[model samples]
Target: MVTSARPQFTAFIGQQLLASGPLAEVAIAVMNASRNPAAPPIIMFADASGQPIDLDLRGTERDVVARLPQPAPDREAATEEASTEPRGRGRPKLGVVAREVTLLPRHWEWLGSQPGGASVALRKLVEEARRANGDADRARAARDAAYRFMSVMAGNLAGFEEASRALFADDRRRFVSLIAGWPDDIRDHVVKLAFSDRAEP
Candidate 1:
């Protein structure tokens, strides 16, 4: 879903923006449109700076263009430069295909040495790796979100601890009065963790 959000404009700089001065105008455009990775690669490359600066994109355009996807590599371009180049091939994503690969005797021996694993078809390995990588990325995002919540709540621990203690008090009415309005996220976690604490006689 996220990848689908891309930019369509690639080659053209609008007349007004071109007139306004090169890097100064386009840089703003790129910052505004970063979320849309599919946008024309040229526009994105030109405005990478959050704010615009005065420069002729024409004079500097060669450097800017190098950063963008090219229709084809020039023969004079170094191989390393070619490898780093973007193909500007449009948003059509070609998936990595899985196929059998011949393994050297040492490599085969290495595969056998792995614990909790055996030689799997290369297709399975590729698919599983993609799935695992996706999951790790999602997990990292969730961890960051949870940590933000934890940071806010960590500042209010004394209040939560007091409310939690109130819930364990002998006087039911007093306990109810004490924790009547705790933050829902905190209350939910506290209640679950303490649910077993009430089981004993």
Candidate 2:
């Protein structure tokens, strides 16, 4: 049931964070609460990558969610198209496309020599690469996402530089130690964003 569409978010009211969780709709609601003239000048909502999410305050909550980026089409569903006609040359019933791939002569020769032809070989190579790099890719993404949140919310805090160093180095202990003095909500949210994808020690 894993889906790339699930969004993660954090909200801030001035320098103090208000909440961190899924659902941009809820984040927008929290941001709205702090929008009065007397409140802090900046009420921001950022995604897991720390990019600011623009919410049109005049719209309904559902409208706000609808404005967020939707997931790409399901590949499996797209490939399942039922057709009565024959597929054309270089076209696949699996929805494959025949794009010109410029490869060195030797590379092309090697691919052509594979059992099922260049296309099948290339697909196998791609699937193997994805399987091999999946974990590393997810870890790198987590680090980047956490760093984004930290830069926006705690860049000026004490030990931020050291904390950042520890974060990139994957030294969880040192990172936690450096940010221990930050406000409870901010510290907790940072830890969650950084480690939410990682398994417990």
Number of backbone collisions per candidate, in order?
A: 6, 0
List residue ranges in candidate 2 displaced over 4 A.
Answer: 1-5, 19-24, 41-47, 74-101
Off by over 4 Å in 1: 1-56, 59-67, 70-120, 138-201
lDDT top scorer: 2
Best by TM-score: 2
lDDT of 1 by residue, 47-127 (tens): 111121232233353554445443332322332343465744321232223447688988777766675333334434655
TM-score of 2: 0.75
For 143-187, candidate 2 gives per-residue lDDT tens digits of 887788788778899999999999999999999999999988778
Tell how far residue 114 is off in model 2, in angstroms: 2.9
